[model samples]
Target: MEAPLDPVSAETVSISADQRSRPYLRLFLISFVLLFAELACIRWFGSTVILLTYFTNIVLMACVLGMSVGCLAASRGRNWINAVLPLGLVAIGLACWTLQAYERGEMSIAAGDQSAPQEIFFGAESVQQAPLGRTYPIEVVAGLFYALIALMFVGLGQVMGRAFNAIPNRVAAYTTNVFGSLVGIAAFALAAALQTPPRVWFALALVPLLGFVTRFRPIQVVALVAILFLVGWLPPARNGAARQVTWSPYYKVVFQPSTAVIETNNIGHQQMASIGNSGAAYLLPHLLNRDAGGRPFEDVLIIGAGSGNDVQAALSQHAKHVDAVEIDPVMASIGRANHPNRPYDDPRVSLHLDDGRSYVRKTSKKYDLIVYALVDSLVLHSGYSSLRLENFLFTEQAYRDIQARLKPGGVFVMYNYFRQGWVVGRLVKMVEKAFHMPPIVISLPYRAKITPDQNQAGATTMLIVGKTEAATAAIREKLAESGAFWIHVSPAKNAALNGYGAKAPEVEGTMKEHWWKIAPSVVETRGIGPLPSDDWPFLYLRSSMIPGLNLWGIVIVAVLSLAILARFAPPATTRPNGRMFFLGAGFMLLETKGVVHLALLFGSTWIVNSIVFFAILVMVLLSNLFVVLVRPRRICWYYGLLIASLVIGAFLPMDSFLALPGASKVILSCAVTFVPIFFAGVIFATEFRDSRHPDVDFGSNIGGVILGGLSENLSLVVGFKHLLLLAAVYYLLSAAFKRRAEPPAS
Candidate 1:
């Protein structure tokens, strides 16, 4: 139906096009220089300290070089088979690597049961264990898979240059990309509330729409940053330093509350939270009853081993062997090097750098006393105002795994930080429900000058003890006879009881006696309870509304409005090539999401969050400056788009991994930071290549990011990390769309 296309010469484009994009090349050089600096940092400091920094540098450098060279090589618009094909291969590699990280399914840091028989009865239970298996080697394989996928994504970016040229009504494509991103974000955000079938479709469609949005205008960047910051600061967002207990008079009320200690090291001196030593000090006396402590504990299992204090204490107890499961590797390393007390030296202590749940599941050996110093609630209890809930850590199945690993008569000790009157009842209820046995609770009141009611005042730590049914009734009777505290017994006969032994809170609706019915089976199996509808003062820490929650639904309508507005406006002053606006926007959004997600993956501190927020802010400010400086020429504008995309792709990861893993938490942070950053850099770079204008590009990119943030929070409701994976794929698809649009000229 079409006239012959003039034999579509392979190298027919103007020489001016190459000249036009040189600025983009120059920008790429700057990006590479930045990455070289990061690489220098890694070389001088060591990988452990600057692990994230290293990867970020590599990703940025690769993306910059790839884009700059690829685009330069194809200035004359070569056919897709020659120019874009190689880039597509690279994108595919990157995508595979990025996606591989979560393919193994997320596991906790603590060790627990691994090979236990699944309960074939429950309908939804199978869904939970579907991905469960020997996942260690699988994890590495998965990483490689994602790496390849990322490569594919990069390749896709190279092909996009040609695709946009073929489309009719270029302005319409720009509007569609922006609108598509907004719609995709809305769809992803809403998927959390809807049923599975509809949500699946939304999740699937979200990827390409995201790809389309990445290629937009710069004004959208500011709007996107505003949205990201809004979501980042959402009340429910998780922060760690928010609730860290400072040294205070009330310290006595909380046994084993952490202390910050400054120590000198080769890397210079810094302060770190010391928890294991304090916990060991508190528990050591009880383990040997202060007897001649040449060696008291024969065998030990330490859950949540902080700073290796418990392991040292166990060593002091001279246990023949100890299985130490510390959830935070950063902390573990600190303990290994500077803990003042090191357990790694002990031949008996075996360090398992696995999640506590999985460790217990895999190991059949039982210990004399299983010390669960940190409970399931603590998993979600970051010391921050942002309510980031580690939802998987608190499920009912976790408790059952613990139960399965314990010897029939083994004692289980946990620390419950609550000192309120009726709160003890709730804790006891949770314990009984999980243990399926009556627990003899005892409160070790730390007698200090502080009052308990002054919640801010540090008081002595009170201990909660629960024993199995096989434990002597005399122990229970003794607990019951202690009239010094209020106690609550369950309705069931001879059921587990809470030895609160204290008066209730004076507030209205506060009751003196404490007993609540809990689903024993649920409690015994998984530590997780039903998601609470109403916020509990002790439990609920933060809140936030998703961005553009209402307006997002009509993004298509909004694009239409923009189209009408564009029709009446001064013809864009300078319109970008085809879908460039959409592609650029997708890259920006993908880069930001990648930074944040990488932070989560590597266990990096909230600094990554700060960088992400700041980068967006900087991007907006810089874009405004460029608009004023460059005066809207097509080549300059296009260069501006390319520069912004490359810089974003390169730098975001650097910000993510600047802080290296030193202590347990630090190591966790390192692990979290790199993967997300690498993937983000790769994906964004790919997307940017296909983007046209700055405004729509920025808008759609930001919209995708907003959706990513929203998805992170909503993960509490959904079961898998698939949502996160989908977000990364969205960027990949954008790259693919670019390739499709730009099929190399034959």
Candidate 2:
């Protein structure tokens, strides 16, 4: 019923709802479904199986391969959407269990090893074993899942492809598709922020999938239910019980009620324990500070203060104030409610759920003591190698930032069961370089041959650095008087400490004598290890190179992509539009550079990550809008601007953005990061509008994007800044390819 604007006016205006064309609605639905499904699978597969954490790129590549094939095959005029999706979901669910983090035999990729100059998966360092009877190689397992995931997306892509073909104005269709994707990302992100369960995510996906299905038979109904069951399947415990799992923005967190142990992605993450009852290592820095300076710490800061063990320890030491910074909110929540000591509940403790380095950089307060306690997470970047949640927390630049926030005589301590001695040596060197003084070191289970220990690196080692040389001098003097840098509490104290928790690491004969050994010189500390900079904050990596596992993954994905293209692509246009393909490839890298740059300028928090993604799409949308409104025919201008922006971005390093004032930083960073992408999008939309076959061009573009994803590995060798140059090469090639393929009429 329509109401009149004015009561006095007898003339009633009839208003009818502007109908959205069915093809556009279908396009929106399919695009929304594809994005949600892709994100859901990426987040779920890694968290559920745990083994797939390192192989996330495979899942990503598989989606690209599938969609590429599906879109390319749309010309054949056949309905690709059928019962295949649910069947594919079944296969994926089965793959999650058949392959896992650990089994009868160890499963590890190149990053699995604890050696130098190799990619490092942080939380995967601990030796793992499962009760299974047999196992397959990592290569074989990764390959199997890659093919399965790709097959599932093939059907969805074809449906979306057909939708695109139905629309006459390709620009309008592209806008709707991008807008749908934006909505999908925002919705999924909101669901994650709300800490919705896996079932909710799958349910959200099921809504769109049901729309595409033609049949509602009993078998199809069963298939839909089965998909929910598979994705929401909880990891079963050893005693045939399912552990309660919580979905964090980052990972699937499982907390053991009895042991107070918290696990992420089925791997042991942290424990809520008391220092008075076996967490003595947590007090070492304060003890060292007190013994050296004969004063208690007034203000303390604990980065990576997982589950409040560190915070509780600070309180136990009688700190006046404690600032605990933890990245994962779910981890902090469990710590607050479950930790026996109630650290987070303490009046002195203030918990901040944020990225550690980011917190440290922003806080104006200076601390007498700062602790980096056992901070590690398994968060690999989709485009880069072995990036963890805590990666930026350990870089030389990060250390400098921490040092700036320290009180004049403040002492900084970071302790971890760092799997390798080289890791320790690298860390020590970084601290020394940043602080301008060699830090005091305490390596538990210390031994001769500094480069030895079968890569054990003296498990549970601690490195202590003072803000200045004078503070460090006092620490050294106290250590010298104490005979050794180790702690040797009486047997009674040791027993009391172990009463409430697991036994802390102890030296062989440490009832009264030394509990630690004097660290060796830089030479014995291990041959000049490379320092981690802001540009390359890969603390766990041995060096800047792609790990072997990823190398094989890229090759495998490329090969499978080729095979799929050959099989499903139409004979007439089997090859993708090369120009569009190259543009897609280059744009992917351009997009990564934007994300990495902003991540560096700000912090790599989930919020920041999501915003960067949204912003990138927004830029694309804006550029596409310009093309749709203006309808520019010439592409040469955009190519020039795109290349110029790439060059500007490449030369302007991320570190420069760090010093800018708050408002300026946001403004300049966005311009530098988003401008190139904006230009790139304009070029793509212009070409897309001109394409005779949108499906083929799009498929080709996706295929090229896969190649760009592959080239991201080179960032390991050249670093993120140089990636712009590589992207520029691709853009130039794209322009050249277009010029040669379709010359302007003379």
Candidate 3:
């Protein structure tokens, strides 16, 4: 009792204690940083790379690839967490700056009417008039840049995997990792909420580096701070009072003072100039005029009412009341600030920040004029799915619902800069099929001069669909007087108009055929393809084939990932775990489905997506906790529960659920949709708890996410709801390969 311990023994004991605690803290930090980096990439990559705006899952796949490579390194007993992570941050910042410079140069040239060298990586397809030719040199250079960015993420993945391997209790480590991820999501979300730019994100990400580094070098700290500042301080490509660019949760919004217009991702979105101020007096003129009997519209509804332009149009027409629905909060805020008419502030107008389709389905009020403004999205809704923000709005079924919201004699008007003749035909067909009546089509040239390359910018097309022929006739007479050129879309209407000696609108010979012959052929052959529905919402894409650049990019990255895995991952780490892989893939699919389903049921706003993601994480964390606390031994029972939940989800009527009141619908939908996800989480946690080498298993599980991302493309063919069946199949395969274990004695 009196014997004193030696100094060496005491030092060894202290070191042992520190070593035991170190991995836990490191794992948590690594997880937090990994998530932060992923979010940063999503935002930055999507904005810089135009291709990513359409195919966002590529960025997600890159993040997964990096993590998988890191796990391989950990299995090989390699650790470069401290050295590579901070350096990676600096590298990413520099890369972003360089890319922005390149983009600015290209855009400036394009805007000046000079054809810039085509970007080979994104391809010539996006450029309207650019000739299709392979620029191998540009492709090679861009590919290397993409690879470098991917490699930076590998360092983060390695740190997380090594920390996971170091921890004694795998379940505890996993729970901690999930908790850290939650924190990472919250931190990023908070930054976004504050409208803090990329610099703040970099600063937050680098702060964790202080704990990782052993020798605190002042130069390293200075370098890191400088990089953060550089990233934040760098000027955007397009910057001026004429152009105001801001980051929104959904898009990079650009407002032009000259035109008083707001564009998203270089695509014309909304004309901010009020009718009274702008020379475009012909725009929505029919809406301004009295009805068939010269009666004024009592109420009007404007969906996709961006920048309050349509609301102002309704107000100028002296409508008693106007309901304006705009999905994006940022757009609404901008409208409130900038709209010269101040229509949103008008007593007659009620602004609803909601999904257009959801609003039409749930609202009790009916309107005399239901105007579908330029409700088109330039980007996908989520990275995983092909669904766009306005996918639900253009569906055939959606048109029917919109028609129901209109009074008996009320007219439904939809107009957009439908560039492709086939796209215009598809919309015309959709509206005709919904109402069983031919819609009046009007095509007008852009009010301002535009280059041939800016064809979409140079034309405005309108479709006027009426609940009755009398209503249609009333609008037709008004539009006829406004010098609007009518294009016959429906076969019966086309024949009747021709017999009446109504000449087709004068245009380029090729363009005339495109509108008359080619347009109708598109509908006749059904070659314009499946009209977007709730089940399959991809309004922009005509075919199931992934775009050329997207396909190539995916293939290249996949090949590169496989090469890295084969070269660095040890043979022992490559052992097949079908159960884990399948579970992981299924879980990812389920998560994607949940997000899209909830977005449709609630709204496609960023807040809804964030809540869904956060809720999923919480469910997964709780499942892991349940596995630890209860130590549930009946794995089969959990599997059964998972299958049952999926069955219910598959057969459950989404329309009926959507019919419920908004609050009740959101709550019930969450419960129904997430129940399967909860059970799936339980199954994953239970199996993970039993894994002997969780680092290897965890890496494999993440690998499954890659496959899941690839499978998400199936939504293009099968539609989204059917994706649950595909997910169930993966789960079944997982259960088939699962190893049996005896229940623990109570």
Candidate 4:
């Protein structure tokens, strides 16, 4: 019973045990850092790089690419984990600072005699418009920057993959990884909850740094200190009198005292001027006086009540009570603190922080006035899809729901700085269709002068929709008495008829004239074109036409990256099974679909996104635990269950859920959406457990995620629900390709 081991053998056994234990810790640290980095990229990089905000999936795809490269490297027995991790952190940090400086207009380059080129990387040219015409240079530079970011991720991925391969119990390692990810999410979320700025977020990198680099050399220590110092020191520039800068869950909000406007990442969001001085107030008197017929409004509802300016306007109109619904809490808080009107603190105002459309649907009480005031989002809903936060609010059905919320003789007024004449025409047409009557459209210029030649195309447009014809007539009369320049769009002719009278000759081809008379018909005849619906809410994009050059460029880069990966990390001789690849692709599609669907149901707040991501990880963790414990023998059963769940989800009445109580709606939606996700997890775990080479399998899975990210763009062409069908097809393909395995020896 007592055969003693030789000294050398005993030492070797002790070292092996120590090595085994060390990797679990490494796995946890790596997982935590990777997730933290991901969130940082999504938030920090997204805010700084304008294109990143529009095409958010690019960041996800880049991360996947890097991680895939790293995992592939691990499979080839090449691990540069320690050397690459810290360098990657420093690289990303510096890139973020440089981008932020450029975005703030601090960075400049002399081109010939010009101080700066007409088209710079983070200039106005980057926003809203399709990436066409002289945009290639910007695109090239952005692509290279993103590629570097991917390379950084590759290093982290290699570290993680190495740790994962070393651990004998894959399930245990996976659990630790998931747990660490949750911690990362929680930490970042907490920082956001506290309104931590970018500097505080940068400091979070130290957690992983401390864990991984226990014995840093003098040079390494100096580099780490310098990086941290730069993160804190590199101040974000201000446009006007920058009173405060803070991070909301969804945006980086800045309050400028001189302008009295709240901005999201330097873009104007909410004007906080006094009620008398505000541009928004121009439409208020018209609505209150004309629709109310001099009677005081008993109750008012203001959607997108940013900075409480609209609420203050309502209060000034002697509304007895006001319901202000705003989605961003940090923005609301700024309104409370910095608004000169102090409308939020008034007893008459009851602020509800929620999605505007969701509030409209849920509220039982009706109001005399419903104002949709300057409610546009600065950023798109998701990078992959051309949807926005306010997309649901502008839909035709949403207008109908809003119409239903109006009391008898009540008025629904909307004011926006519509950038194009066609956009103004489109909103007017939508209102006419909803109310069965043409709206009274007024064009208010930013400056006091109203020249007939002045292109009213870009002016602040207001639509006053009346519940009754009498109310409309009264509003029209009041506007005429005030000598305001307004137009009544002829719904049938699609012509802009002069509302001011024959005394004022119509300015031909101007918004005052016909002003793109064919805009509405063009929109209508296009057959669901850019007009947003609950199903397809791409409000920012004008059409479904894909940016051909941009799409092709991305594809080329992906192909080239793939070639490089192939050259460096050759696959195993067994041809490395592709069943896992399909499963990975399908799973990514499901996750993207879920994120979008949930964003539509709930608000597309940062909290909602984080929660959805956390929920997905938890679901995957549960699936792995189930497989590890139950060890299901029939993969067919799991696949069948997955398909059935998806089918159920596809047919579920989403509108019915919207009508339920808030908690009930959330619970039901989660059940319908996540049931399929759970089954998908089970299927993946079943296949992944049998993988001969975990590193290669993991890399393949990540590679599939890149394809899934690209495929997500399909949502723009075919609405989001159809994406579920696409995902199901991928899952079916996975099932078809799945190689059957013999039962484990009994």
- What global local distance difference test value does model 4 have? 0.65
Q: What lDDT would candidate 1 get against the real structure?
A: 0.34
**Taking the tens digit of each residue's C-alpha lDDT, what string does model 4 give over 342-436?**
99999989999888887887788987889997887776665545567787887677788888898887788887765544455556667778899
Query: Which parts of model 2 have CA positions greater than 4 angstroms off?
Result: 1-20, 99-117, 123-132, 215-217, 239-242, 381-386, 452-454, 485-529, 570-573, 739-746
Off by over 4 Å in 1: 1-281, 284-297, 336-343, 374-392, 416-427, 438-467, 472-478, 481-699, 715-746
Cα lDDT of model 1 by residue, 1-746, tens digit: 21121223434344366753543333332222222222222221111111111122223222332332222222233332232223323433333232232233332111111112110011111112324333232223222322322232222223332232332222223233333333333433233223122214312432222233334455334433332232112111011222211111001001111333321110111233233323422342233222211234466787766457666656655578888875444445556765655577778888865455546655779765666543322211121111222222233444555666666555565543333322333344545667775444443333322221222112112322323564323334433454232212221111122322333323333344442111111112122223222111122111122223212322322343244224322225423222333334334334433443433433222333334433433443343334334323223234343434434433343223323333654454333433343333333333333333323332233333323432333323332223334443444444444322231234
Q: Which regions of candidate 3 deviate over 4 angstroms?
A: 1-22, 82-146, 214-223, 233-243, 256-263, 266-268, 277-282, 285-293, 446-458, 477-526, 544-550, 570-578, 651-653, 661-664, 736-746
Q: Model 3 over residues 543-644: C-alpha lDDT tens digits?
A: 655544445555776777677677667545557466777888898899888988887787676677778888999988878777777777667888888877
How far out, in Å, is residue 172 in model 1? 24
Candidate 3 residue pairs in clash (backbone atoms < 3 Å): none
lDDT of each: 0.34, 0.73, 0.66, 0.65
Q: Assess the local accuracy of residue 176 in candidate 1 as a C-alpha lDDT between 0 and 100.
A: 32
For each candidate, how many residue pairs have backbone atoms clashing (under 3 Å)?
144, 5, 0, 1
- The residue pairs that clash in candidate 2, if any, are 117-542, 117-543, 277-497, 278-497, 486-516
Model 4: ten consecutive residues of lowest lDDT: 515-524
Top of the candidates by TM-score: 2
lDDT of 2: 0.73
TM-score (C-alpha) between model 4 and the true structure: 0.82
lDDT ranking from best to worst? Answer: 2, 3, 4, 1
